[model samples]
Target: MRNFMSKKLLILSEVFHPENFVINDLAMHWAEEGCECEVLTRVPSYPAGMPLKGYRNRIYQKTHSFGLPVHRVGIVSGYQRNLVRKMLNYMNFCFLTTMMLLFRGNRYDRIFVYQTGPLTVALAAVISRMLYRQKVIIWSQDLWPDTVFAYGFRKTRLRMVMLNVFVKWIYKRCDIIMVSSEGFIDKIRKMVPGSEVIYVPNWPDINCKRVGIKSLPEGFNFTFAGNVGKVQNLRNVLAGFALFAEKNHPNAWLNIIGDGSNLKALKSLVEEKKIPNVNFTGFRPPNEMPSYFAASDVLVISLNDAPLFELIVPLKFHSYLTASRPIYAIVNGEVTRLVKRYSLGVSADPSDIESISGGFERLYYASQTELKNYSANAAGMTRNGYSKEKNIAMITSILWPSEIGLKQADLHRAM
Candidate 1:
């Protein structure tokens, strides 16, 4: 391999800084490793669907964050509330990013496309690989088409065929395909049989800082943090929590800490049901999550009963493990398997209200020793392998094998 320090690394993604995405951390890590890392992305507007304060959607914007240069092309402003607008935004991003790559003469040794959302953004990477002979690596955080349907899109044979064809094109161009979940391995390999598909789990948001426990609501709190979206199956969570509060634990409280597209509807449901002991704390910064998690008795993770979810290990699960709080996993498949395997916490079916209630009951009434055991398991899992450092090492090995190998040896020696 060529000298890592001399390598120019470019990251192409629709979401980057100012949006709570993990690619920011990776770009910083590569810069620290002495690579001339740069990120080509859109003006930061995501989850909220509007440009963040102090940023405007410009034709072209150049900035730096944590020592790495970020080049923002066009803006795909509001899409969080409306589907039509969302599609338009995605298309706009794809068009602008593709155009920039075609015109920009900046050379890079390798290009990494953070295929966290739409596979359409990979067009830039594909162009780079095909036109410039650059190595392209994709770290897929969400499976395409499957995720499209998961978002409530109607699936059809024609749609499936078209998406399959598009997905194959994207996968074929990548030198290496990395998935954030182990369950995504077979599916990806089946699409690109000869491509190297590796399992590289995502770490918790690197921006999160561990803080001392802060003041929390009265009574035992079961906290569900992060995006409050339909895919989270939050309706079932609210229903199950209501049942648990009414029937078994009157003093227990359900705290939802995040904001998303489903926030308004969810609030309406809460008002309609007049569910007691429920509090909604709109989104908070990542740095504040540690204190919030520390204040809670148990952390909850729930996802809708969809085939796509069965193959996912949500990023929040990783953050929950780091919090060392006993988890109540109202999810199925790989998430359930890992929770049970490691004795992280209780697991239940997301679609079954009664089952979810039972899961909450089990955790709320669990003995201190039992809770300690679960907490210990959570810590053990993170330390054993699932960590930001480990994930970065896995990716760096693929992108800059010789250099990262030397860096790892130095790290081991320093340790």
Candidate 2:
């Protein structure tokens, strides 16, 4: 810990900031909390299947984002799951990052590993522990071995069983665990029943001057943000909106932000239906997210018949909570639970048009007084608990547990 005035944290995450999502939010949050965070991350190319333009040829690079120094590892760029290519991408990252860190002229106190591709990154953590006796904190974003099957990844049964064994073995070696949602805690508890899994729900910079709330233009407008992934039941969302739009065309507009594989199909569906009220405005900057939601009287989130998503909370949900508008969440699991608990939103079944129609009506006709109450409550929830500051402190507490004497001796040596 030589001259390391702040806690020296090594974050091994598959994703990082400026890719524009909650992983970035957490990374930025960690950097702001007086912790000297060094992230070993893959180049920005998730969902897009292409590396960010400037970084296409980069290998072993360092850059600053949100005041955090990010160390980038060059992984195989063609990251799709075409068997050999996918294996190469994951392997190269694990090998390169592990080697880079060993040679990089710094001593990190404790290493925090974010699990999305748990196997490849777990190898890095295991090697780190073996090489340096480093403290390994597995802050799992998703539980693997089981999740491979959940995401419907292609693999032989025997291979999956072996993978599961390896992933669980890595979990057992971790010094601590932090999960992003309440639902993850429940699911992981069922697996490692007595294991330690702390809840550190996703946070964004909620205090950096939120967008002013605007009134719906004497008509109902709805919006949905986040990935256009397989699990996002836009089929049902578009269907419900069409029924309302057919009757009250200009009175309603459905604005979608974010992009994904399902985008082209969704656009064609809108054209075919002549759904005049629906509009697609691709990705927007995180700071610009406020007006996008504020312009709408209500925000919507949708999920399909996947038990895995139920156990996972998408970061977009937090953005909706930050929007300071009512959310008509078509979701199951913890998101709906949060929506109801916060008294900030209402929910309907994702597949049920009748229920969604009913929710649209309530939002469309809601009095100014009622909307005021919801906005105030949503802002209060964000300010009182879910700001970036709160999450940073929570994670720091988890890292330096000795600060509270939760561990014997000085774990400062680990730092």
Q: What's the CA RMSD for each of the models?
A: 3.2, 4.4
By lDDT, the best candidate is 1
If scored against the real structure, what TM-score would every candidate get? 0.94, 0.84
What is the lDDT for 266 in model 2? Answer: 95
- Per-residue lDDT for 1-415 in model 2, tens only? 1232256778888777656545665566665656677888878887575687777547778887878788887767666535477778878887888787677525776788877655568677767676777788876767666567665677798877787677666766677767776677765666565667777777653233546643334566788877786678898888877776666557677878878877888999999977777778876555667766777777888888567667777777666767788778887777788778888777887768877767776777779888777777777887876777667655656676665554522332322
- Model 1 off-target regions past 4 Å? 1-3, 206-208, 211-213, 402-415
Residue 269 error for model 1, in Å? Answer: 1.0
Tens-digit lDDT track for model 1 on 1-415? 2365577888998888777777878887777767777889888877788888888878888988878888897665678888998898888888888877776625887899898788998888898778888889899989987999999889999999999999999899998788888888899888888887777888877344666666668899999999898899999999998888888576799999999989989999999998888889998877789989988989999999999999999889989998888999999888999999999999999999999988988898899999999999999999885878877866777777566455534433432
Candidate 1 C-alpha error for residue 187, in Å: 0.6
How far residue 392's Cα lies from its native spot in candidate 1, in Å, is: 1.1
CA lDDT of each prediction against the hidden true structure: 0.85, 0.71
For candidate 2, the lDDT comes to 0.71
Most accurate candidate by TM-score: 1
TM-score of 1: 0.94
